[model samples]
Target: MMRSLGKQTVRTHYQHIVAGVHDPEHDHTHETRQTVYERPDGTFQINYMSGKRFVMATNDGSFECVHVVQTVRSASGSTIMSVIAGAQSLAVNRLNAVIEFESGDRWIEIEDDETARLAAGLTQTAVGHFYHEEERLEGRHLRRWFVLVGPSEDLAVVGKVALFVLPPHETSVDPEVVDCHIAGYRNGNPYPEFAAEIEALAAATDLPITPNYMGDPVVTPPATGRTPGL
Candidate 1:
């Protein structure tokens, strides 16, 4: 069975670790202490990035999925959302969704069990703002998608990645957060690449291709197809 979050109030814990290796992304291996939080909710979200970078790991409970994020930040100051919807490249099975929403509600809806599993099974876990907290309305206006993953899952493969989609004119920069790491980002979708995995998931789901909700339109998903899950 999968673990999930309940209605109880919770607090995050902090930890520090040191290792000897080279990080291609940052060109460094040493890491600063970071905070980690596990929402008992079925999403299996694992906040494991170092305090220097804003990243996340997630579990896709409802669909047998997993995801990660190398959260990007915006150079400009604005309320934005980086939504995921398609695959990155044809060589891998990861989905890529790095879309920016500056002024409207967004959603990453799963239409069926197959799609849910596909969405959950990808690599990482993250959220977007097509359904973020905006204006005076509550968070309900912004629809978000959650997936299931476990603590023991290995991310050595091309697990799905959640990239932040930055504005066309802005440069993506690493965040300078201190103390507690952040789960939210404004740059853009962390993964903007595409893959066959997305095409398979779309075939097994029921959300409309060109969808609209809360006076805003969602990004078009990959073309649909039949896969093992369906």
Candidate 2:
């Protein structure tokens, strides 16, 4: 009865028992955080903590060229949220940026000087990109302000702003904007010092001055996390 271990198979499993194969759970780590919540129907909801990365697609309804970290299902053996390092867009990253922001609270004062400087540069760059469009009478100044805030700066400000590009579906934080604002307050920035520029430039045009107000609240980041010494 020991004739053979042969044949109807997806591949030659015995022959192709090699490293770096197509095993989805191969690199899965034990560090992945999982939390279970009991529903009224006695069904359990599980939250799987995974890092952010770009995803081309998934069998689930979530389909995007970017990695998506969502609390959708409670399946313990569900697919891991894998993300590509150095992914292009932070807005679409599959990371728990809010958690990172909360973790970063311990270092806020130390980081923002540099973070703010970078944000200021992006702010200046955005101003240039919208110059021609501003002449076309398009307003969304806050949206324009958000263009290059990156994960640290702008994306954290997503839900707290009057004009937010992304929806408020997940728990997140924008360290860049808040940090930069803090840096500006501690140091100096033409953003607030010369905020009147936006108002002046917008008076004869349709640009909004609300983005000018973005500075004040930024110094005091939202109650998104544990803001140390504040």
Candidate 3:
């Protein structure tokens, strides 16, 4: 006798037939026993010892069978070398912007601006690079400035300036330094407009003037010009 079963009914009928013939005490020396797995996606995976096989039923009421041969082979020396070369090439292509200062201190720029901004809030000191055009009589020439906001002592010497903070906003870039007062400078020099305020604060705390030099090359700003509501 022969009978056809629907997709949903096939699983139940198949399980019943398989259970009736399955041997629990079968020996594996000749061949491995069949194993059935019911997937959550309403699919059955039947495994055999010889090779891999997949039986799939499609929505068009057709069955597709795939047989994959499994083989084990040792890696050759050339294959291992090729894999290492590919890994090295991938690493070189994914390198990020990093800076090493003369004082042996290194600062790696965060890939994301928002993440960098959040990180800056956890520290009392921060350094950033900004692009601004000083409004001079010479038609506003663009200039790149490195900003440092930290303790007076750290700012006083170029070798001590270690903090590096990426600006948050893309356009109106500004580094956020928390609980820091009486410190703000650009290109290792105190802001000209805030010179009086800085001097007063320094005098009160006996802080020395920061050197007028940055020990490393000026960092290029990621973007130029100001944007509203970035």
| Most accurate candidate by lDDT | 3
Report RMSD (Å) for each prediction in the order shown.
18.8, 20.6, 26.0
Preferred candidate (lDDT higher): 1 or 3:
3
Model 2: lDDT to the true structure: 0.25
Q: Candidate 2, residues 1-230: lDDT per residue as tens digits?
A: 12221211111011111132443332211111112233455433332112222222225422223121232222553322212112223422422222122223211111122332233232322222222222233332223222212233522321111111222232224322221121122122334433333223234234333332324443322233322121
TM-scores for candidates 1 onward, in order: 0.24, 0.18, 0.17
Model 3 Cα RMSD, Å? 26.0
Clashing pairs in 3: none
Model 1 C-alpha lDDT per residue in residues 85-113, reported as the tens digit of each score: 22311212333232212211112333233
A best-first ranking of the candidates according to their lDDT comes to 3, 1, 2
- Sorted by TM-score (best first), the order is 1, 2, 3
TM-score of the candidate numbered 1? 0.24
Off by over 4 Å in 1: 1-17, 20-137, 141-194, 209-230
**Could you give me the TM-score of model 2 versus the true structure?**
0.18
Model 2, which residues run further than 4 Å from truth?
1-192, 211-230
Model 3 TM-score, all chains together: 0.17
Worst 10 residues of 2 by lDDT: 8-17
